[model samples]
Target: MNPFYFVFGRSANMVLILIFFFCPVSPSYGYDPLDPKGNITIKWDLLQSNSDTNDVKVSLLNFQLYRHIEQPGWKLGWEWLGKEVIWSIQGAEATEQGNCSRFKGGQLPHCCENKPLIVDLLPGAPYNIQTSNCCKGGVLSSMIQDPTKYAAVFQMNIRAGGAADSDFDMPQNFSLGVPGYTCAKPVQVAPSKYSSDGGRRWTQALGTWNVTCIYSQYQASTSPKCCVSLSAFYNDSIVHCPKCSCSCQGLPGSKCVKFGETPSLLQQVKDPNQEPPSIVRCTQHMCPIRVHWHVKQSYKEYWRVKITVNNLNILKNYSGWNLVALHPNLKSLTQVFSFNYHPLNQYGHINDSGMFWGVEYYNDMLLQEGEVGNVQSEMLLHKDEGIFSFREGWVFPRRILFNGDECVMPPPDDYPRLPKNTARAASFTLSIIFSPLFMLLIIFAC
Candidate 1:
């Protein structure tokens, strides 16, 4: 090398090293508290299945858990919010498959993403943030496969209490996240279903789709927005990924990530057998259209939904609101009923994708806060698929307000009973039982 060039290169290397030492990495943390629109919370619960002293399986309830990885090694970055704007991690790190490396090398050290999960965790949150509400990730293939290894890796450090030994009472916050070896990238649902023929017809291939965990927030519509056609403009109405922008994971290596994921979720509804329809609850801040579902009949085929406006300030006059109901288990929607007060105004029809959305008919249709109104719809079920297969028999889309606000609904709980012929599955139930003594390491089991 030329003397001058060699000296410059060495100096550059030194500067980089110095930068690494003096500067620390920065990862995103929480959403911006000052966003003008409004703030929403994500909810979830932990579900565990116990098998034996050596085996325990974990899953999630309503809320979702996601993982993001920091770029390995030090890199040059600028200071933002008093911390260097570079990816970094503490504690132990799970290596992920296809997390920015080649064919043979970066085989998932264990757990995390291909792209940003969902438009963004929060509407305005940045990429590379510390996603709390997260626990272990990466497919525990070895651990899940071998009881011996499972005991070794997970229980080795955990000291189960015995009658003679000290008991360990550790308070832990149980959470959920995809395992890495599985590299199951996060899934984001389309905000609202789309129809090209002016809500008259819809094709699954034409409308909604899925995306990875760290997907970018829809710039035009924050809460799953939809457009009728390419020419139609989108309002800041729903958080959605436009048809043109939807992406698939496993793209780096050019692998195919299939779409049309039918996620089974529980439903929140009441019984149909009662004389008067049973009342369901709206557990969250589903403002403009705070809804409580009811079962009008016991046939397991038909149900009623009562829609309301909880906050007056948040929802004033929702004149042209189109109520949409999504249930992954629904096979077909035969009819949609009108609200009790304005009977004619609340009728809608089902589209091709099994999404039922009805336009409010009343010209000046409005739902005032503290006022409860309802729209009912009829549905047919695939007896085997809807009742016995999924958790709660429903998986509705995240609601959106007429004014384009995203409404967070509570997890499904109050659901209609399974059709008389079928019963809930005990498939997940296992036989082996473990002593309560081993429960001491519940925290470490994560």
Candidate 2:
């Protein structure tokens, strides 16, 4: 009834329902109490985050402000501003190689890198992360000294001698995902303790952690809206997805074709020009799907592909038709994350080529002859990854509206879907600096 519903509106993400047992990997490390000394440095090398090498001022300060802090989730735009972030606190130091990324202010997932996160004892403190759940003690301390420059200062409450009478404790809120977004599983905590100096010095404990996933509610702007019930976008009336070739549940006839049903005969465009070496303008030489496409619209940290109905044959009231994109020469294809309609399976592969298909319906009204009907979808693409989101979809100029009479591919000065192409993965090197105290130290705060 609303414009958004007509176009693509926010749809519930397919979570909870599709959940299977997410087996937690056993942790190799645990908590051990250390002398509440001058300054203790814990290298929290976080994963799936980016640092600003571009913004020299902020990037430089980040080193000073968050010393020894690994896997910092703060973004260039001061992203972690008001978001609630949680860390699994046990006394165990992360394996030199196996550190997981913290949640990226509701943008990313928490997981081990292409490299698995390995946590073990902290040098002399080889305490196994003992707690069955993580960080159950209570809120220790936070460093929200300046909201303007830091969001990573949110929470870190693991202290010694808490109500649990256990040496280790996680913040009161042991899990991530608050309100609109929530964790799909129950959160647990553990503690590790090692006593030296005859129990005077001890490796108080925090618990071992169970890896889990978070579910985020739909935000401000969702895109390229489509019927995303089962990885198949539906126009319903057109009922032409899965192509009736791979598999289908619909009936047979003009409605359902025998296997290998060819589309209504139309002169197929010449073989699509070889995949362009780099992202470029769509040309007449390019396929009609490419020419009729527009910017992969940017929507809050993500992007979506938008296409205009160039075919007048799609007369108004047309329903149940799937939009297809084929890239004959696509070489590398993998998804960094799992989404509903944009999975690798949805993009069928045969030999070296592949085709991505989605169903779209035009306003439920006739796409009056020649009157271009623009259809947007709910397929959200990560921003930095948007330009390369599709191995072969046409790249367009962002911002400008689609003018039916445009002659050039990206019009003129329009840039690729992603406005800026900075690395989302920031790099950090450990340069242990000595403090005036003359005692060894850990750094994570200014």
Candidate 3:
């Protein structure tokens, strides 16, 4: 009896000590100060979702908070805090699921069942929290859960080498409904017409052709040492003939008379012994002729023409003067008078001494009875008297005058003798006889 009582006493003492050490004295509660051992309580705000329906059976669903340290430049490093204490409201509709417990290894972490988990934060420390759905084949899987509901809150340490908290804000929300619906407008065009000839057309109306009359200066014939008429010839017509006291024929006239036909010849025939049938010949006459002169007085004329062309069709590039011959009728009766443009140059200059005088009738209609040997005259001039005068039935030859060249008849015998000095002596006598006539004109004018 004594041994049993001692053993029982010892067991009772041991039991009391064990109860004092192992049993939770006040519901296993612990305290963590809200501040970092300071006088002020930590201020926090819900950064993500502030309200929830509490429909999920997972911990930390629809949770978020941000803790900010009032002090500047205060940094907090990541450190594990003990498991959180959970509480349930009375009279709430509780599901059959057990109360959410702190997750151990191999168990889906406590936040895995929630859409998002709340993170415990230190003041002024960078942190992040994440959550994922662990259960398969549920409505949560099919529907896109709100990322704000699973976001964690934390304060970022405003210090060097500190990353910003990732789970602080909510992700952009999108609807799971049929992908949301947009379109552009069409451009406008105008109509146009097509041409059959592939060319632009224009309207037509009446137009007038303007005409002008160009007058040529008076021209002298090519015959030598004879007084020729000055006249303007137009379109093969002798329009104007100046009247003067000179031995000049209009179109055609005989330079000599037949010995038997003239009255003087009849008188001479009556006195048969006196040089029987001697003829009284008329003086040589110069017929007016037409000629063209270039405006510059140069044999070569440079014509500069400026054409304002809106449209032009040219087959080939061509440049030069186009000379047209004057009609023979005009050339016959018109006289071409010229003046020297250069004194020393006898070739191109116009000089009174180098005048051209000759008759150029095309048919006997304008010629005297004996003027032309025949009805038709194709030859232009006859070689005679050093003058190379044109004769009856003589034809005009086409000649081109080049620069610095003379248009004289071919020379006779190359060293042909000048007419005898008697002719020159006779010319001097005539000049002497004519000197008084000029003196009288000067005296009359005075």
Which candidate gets the maximum lDDT versus the true structure? 1
lDDT of 2 by residue, 163-182 (tens): 22322221122222112112
- How would you encode candidate 1's per-residue C-alpha lDDT over 181-282 as one tens digit per residue? 111222234433336689898633211112112112233223321211100011112222222221223333222212232212113342221121111122
In candidate 3, what are the lDDT values of residues 301-398, reduced to their tens digit?
Answer: 11111101010101111011011111122122222322111111122332111111112222202121232311211112112333332222111222
Q: Candidate 2, 251: how far from true, in Å?
A: 39
User: Which residue window of length 10 is worst by lDDT in model 1?
Assistant: 149-158
Name the weakest run of 10 consecutive residues (lDDT summed) in model 3. Answer: 307-316
lDDT of 1 at 46: 13
TM-score computed on alpha carbons, candidate 1: 0.25
| Top-TM-score candidate index | 1
Clashes of each: 38, 58, 24
Clash count, candidate 2:
58
Q: What is the C-alpha RMSD of each candidate to the true structure, in Å?
A: 32.4, 31.2, 59.1
Q: Give the TM-score (vs. native) of candidate 3.
A: 0.13
